[model samples]
Target chain A: MADDIAGRGDPIKTLQLMWGRIEAPKRGPKSKLAVADLVRAAVRLADEEGIDAVSTRRVAEAVGISPMSFYTHIPDKAVLLDLMLDAVARPADGSEEAQAFRPEDWRANVAFVAREYRAFYLRHPWVLQVATHRPVLGPNTMRAYDYFLAAFDGLNLSEVEMDLSVTMVANYVHGAVRDVARARMVKELTGMSDDEWWHAIAPFLETVDFSPYPVASRIGPVVGELYGLGDPDRAFEFGLECLLDGLAVMVERKGGRR
Target chain B: MADDIAGRGDPIKTLQLMWGRIEAPKRGPKSKLAVADLVRAAVRLADEEGIDAVSTRRVAEAVGISPMSFYTHIPDKAVLLDLMLDAVARPADGSEEAQAFRPEDWRANVAFVAREYRAFYLRHPWVLQVATHRPVLGPNTMRAYDYFLAAFDGLNLSEVEMDLSVTMVANYVHGAVRDVARARMVKELTGMSDDEWWHAIAPFLETVDFSPYPVASRIGPVVGELYGLGDPDRAFEFGLECLLDGLAVMVERKGGRR
Candidate 1:
C-alpha cells in the first residue's frame, strides 16, 4: 500500500486497467471477484471506516479473495484508491443520462454539476486525502472535466478564461463543501453541537474590544444570522451564485457572449 | 489533543490565555518558559514532524518541562494548538503594521491579504487538520476576518452579499492553495515530481479517445501547458481575479460603490 512511486508499477499500465482498455488477467484463475467487485468492496470499506481502513489485504479479505489475487488486479492501494474515486465520480444512480450537460441552460447546468460534485465529496471525504498532484484521469474523471467545460460551450471565453472559470467554480464549491463536511465529521466525532460550543465561547468573545473591528463586528453576527454560522449549504449556494455571476461578467468583458 | 468537547477546559479561559487576557501561571516556579515559548516549540515539532507528532508530552519534552507544568499553561493539546495557530496567524515578523488594511486600496488590500493567507497555510499545513467546526477565533483570527470585511467597506452590498463575497474570495483561495500545498507535501514525501508522473502516464492518456471530450481535449493540454495542471499558485491567482471580478459586478449591480 505504501509502495514508493517507482516501485508502485507503471502508472500508464494502471490507467489502462482503470479505463478497461486492457483485458482481464489471463494468468489468474477464473475467480468470481472481478475488478468492479473489488472496487465496490473498497469503496464500501472507505465509506464505512474511513480511508485509513482501506488496505489491499483488508479489501481482499472483504471480497473473500487472497491478497495475491488482489495484487494481480491492483498493484497497490494507490491504484485501488484511483479505481474507487472513479467509481464514485459519477452520479449515485449509475445513470450517465442524468449527468448530460444542457447547453441551453448553462448557468443551471453548472449549478447542477457543482451541487452534485459537492455531494460526492461530502459522501467520500477520504477522496480529498488523495492529493490531486498527479490526477489519475480515468474515463469518469475525463467525463467530469468535460462536463464542467461543456457549461461554457458558447460563452466566447478564451480557452484560458474558460479553464479559469471552471477551476474557480470548482474551487469555490470544494472549499465551501470541505468546511461543511469537515464540520459535520468533527461534530459527529466529538458528539458536540455547534450551538453548545458557541454558547460556551460567547462570553470570551464579548471581552474582546470589537470596536477596532467595526465592519466585522457589525456584520459578523448578521452574516452569522443569515445562515447558521457553520452551515455550508447556505454558504455554498451563496458562493456559487457569486462565482456564476462573476463568470457572466467575464463573458461580457470578452466582447459579449455568442 | 483528542479531548472531548465538555471534557476540554473552559474555552473562555483558553481564549483569555490565547489573548493574554490572563496572566502567566503563578503556581509554577520562576521558569524560562512563557506560553509563546511553548507554542513555538509545539509549532516547530509539528513542522518537523506532522500534526500527529504534536502531543503535550512531546512538546513538554522539547521545552524541557514536565507534562504537569505544560498543563499549567495549556489545559490540553487542543488549547495548545489554538495558541499555536494564533501565533502563526500574525505576520511572520510579528509586526501588526504588515497586516494593517489600506481602506483606500481595497482591491490591492484584498489581493495582498489573500496572498499572505495562502502563504500562511503553505507554511503550516497542519492548521487544516484542526477542523473549523469550532473555529478558535483568537484576536488575530478576528482581525483577519475584520480585515477581509474592510475591503468592502463601501461596496454598496447588502450585509449578506458583503459576507458572501468575502467567503467566496476566501474559499477560492483556500481551495486553490490546498491543491498546491498538498502537492508539494506529496512530492516531498514520495520523492516524485508531477512532471515525472505525467511523462510516465502520457502514453496511456493518448490511447483514450479525445474526440468524445471536445472541450477537455481541446483545452486540457493547453491548461496543462499554461501552468502544469496541478500548479496551485497559477490557479490561485487566476481564481482570485475571477472572484474579485464577480465582487465588482455585485457592487455595480447594487448601484455602484460608495
Candidate 2:
C-alpha cells in the first residue's frame, strides 16, 4: 500500500510524458496551455492540501481550463502525479553550483545532496505517498538521481556499495524528515502542541512504574523537552552527523576514501 | 497527515483501557468480548486486508457483536488503533532473552533489537501509518520502548545521546523496511519484476543523453542488476552494518562505549 503507483497509468507512457519527449497535439486548436503549467497547478494543490485534494476537475478549475483540455495534456491523475514529482524533483540548485564542489570533497557533496533532498520532501511530503520504486524517469527526476549518484565519485566503494551507501543516507534523511513532518501533522490534527499533549498525558504517565526503565525514565524527559522546544531540526542534524561519521568509517574500512 | 490520533476519545482513558487498568464492562449482558478481542480482530483485519479495511462495523462484525456494544468497549477508531499498536508493540522476545547479552555487547544487543523491530514492521505495516509521535503509552509500548532504551547500558552516552542513538537506529530501520516493503508492493502492482520493468525502460533510457551523468551511467547497470537478483534485503543489511559501525564510532568519539 505504501509505494504502489498502480493507477498511474502505463509507466512507459508516463515516462515519455514526464521527459517531454511527446509533442503537443497538432490537430487540436493551439492552446496556450503546456504540460508544465498543468503539473505546476496540480503540485500547488498538493502542497496546500494533501494529494487527495488533487483531482482532474479541481486542477482544471484551478488553472482555468476545461477538463477535456487538461486530459489532452495529462491523461489521468497518475500521470499528473508523476509530473508533479518530476517538477519538484528538479535540482533546485544550479548545475554550476553543484559542479563548483571539489571532486575530492565527496562527503561534503553528499551532505549537500542530502540536505537538498530532505528540504524537497519536507516541502512536498505528498511525494512520500507515491511509489519511489519504479518512478517515472522524467528529466528533472533523472537529473536529481544523477546528481546524487555523482556525489560518490572516487569514494573507492564497490558499485553495489556506492548505490547502497547513497541509499542509506537517503533512507535516514527520509525517516528523519517524515518523523518531523508527521509530528507536526499530529500537532495540527490533535489540536495540541507536543507540550500540550504531553502535559495532558503526564498525570497518567506518572502513575506508570518507570522504575524498571532507568534509562528511558531518565532520558525520556530530556528527549521530550528537546522536542518540546519546537525544533525538530535538531534530530535531523544529529542523525546527519552520525550518518556522515559512519560513512567515513565505512570508507576507511573498505580500503580508504579517495 | 502522518501522526494524528485525534478523536481517540480521552488520552488518559484510552491509556487506562490499553494498560488493562480499567476493568472490562460488567454491565454488558455478559457479552464474551473483551477490548483485547476487538483489538485482535482489528489487527487481524489489518494484516489480511490492509489498514483501511479495518472499520468499526467490520471489526464489530468480525467479533460477533453489535456495533453499539463494541462502542462501549472502545469509543472510536482512533482509540482502537492505539490499542492495535499497543497489541503489536509487545516485546515478542523475553527480557530474559534480551538480558542474555553481556553488558559489554551493547552493539549486538542493539542489532538484535533493530532486526526484531524490522520484522515487526514487515508483519504489521499498518503500524507504520499510525501517529508514532504521540504514541498512546500502553504497558506493552512502554516495555518495548524501555527494551530499546536499555540496549545502551554503560555506553557512556548522555541521556539525550542514548535517546537519539536509539531513535537513529529506529529511523534507519523504519526507512529501510518501508523501502523494501514498498518495492515488493510495486512489483505486485506493476505485474513486472524490477528487472522486467528496467528491461522495458532500458531501450528508452539508452536514448537519453548519459554524457552528463558519468557516475549514474557507469553504476546504474550494477544497481539494477542487484535489484534484478530479487534480493532487496541486501540494502537493509548494509545499512544496519553501517549504522552500527557509525554508532560505535560515535560512542568512541564521545568517550567510548561501555
- lDDT: worst 10-residue window of model 2 chain A: A1-10
- What lDDT score is found at residue A33 in candidate 2? 77
Per DockQ, the best of the predicted structures is: 2
Pairs that clash in candidate 1:
none
A79 in model 2: Cα distance from truth in Å?
3.7
Estimate, for each residue in B47-148, the C-alpha lDDT of model 2 and write its tens digit. 876676788899999999887778978977778888888998876655343555567777788888888888889878767665543655777777778788
Per residue, candidate 1 scores C-alpha lDDT tens digits across A1-258 of 111122255677668777887775588467676788899998898788666577788889999988777987777666777788788776567554365665566678778878877887998876655543356688777878887888877777777777877887788887777667656666666776777778877877776788877889888888777665745677788778777776776777776442
TM-score of chain A of 1: 0.82
- Candidate 2, position B245, lDDT: 76
lDDT per residue as tens, model 2, A1-258:
222345646677777877778866779588787888888888898787766567788889888988776887777766777788889887665644355556767668888888888888887877766555465577776677777877876777888888888788888887778766766656655677767777888888777887876767787878777655335577777778788877888787776554
Q: Please report how far candidate 1 places residue B153 from its true position, in Å.
A: 1.6
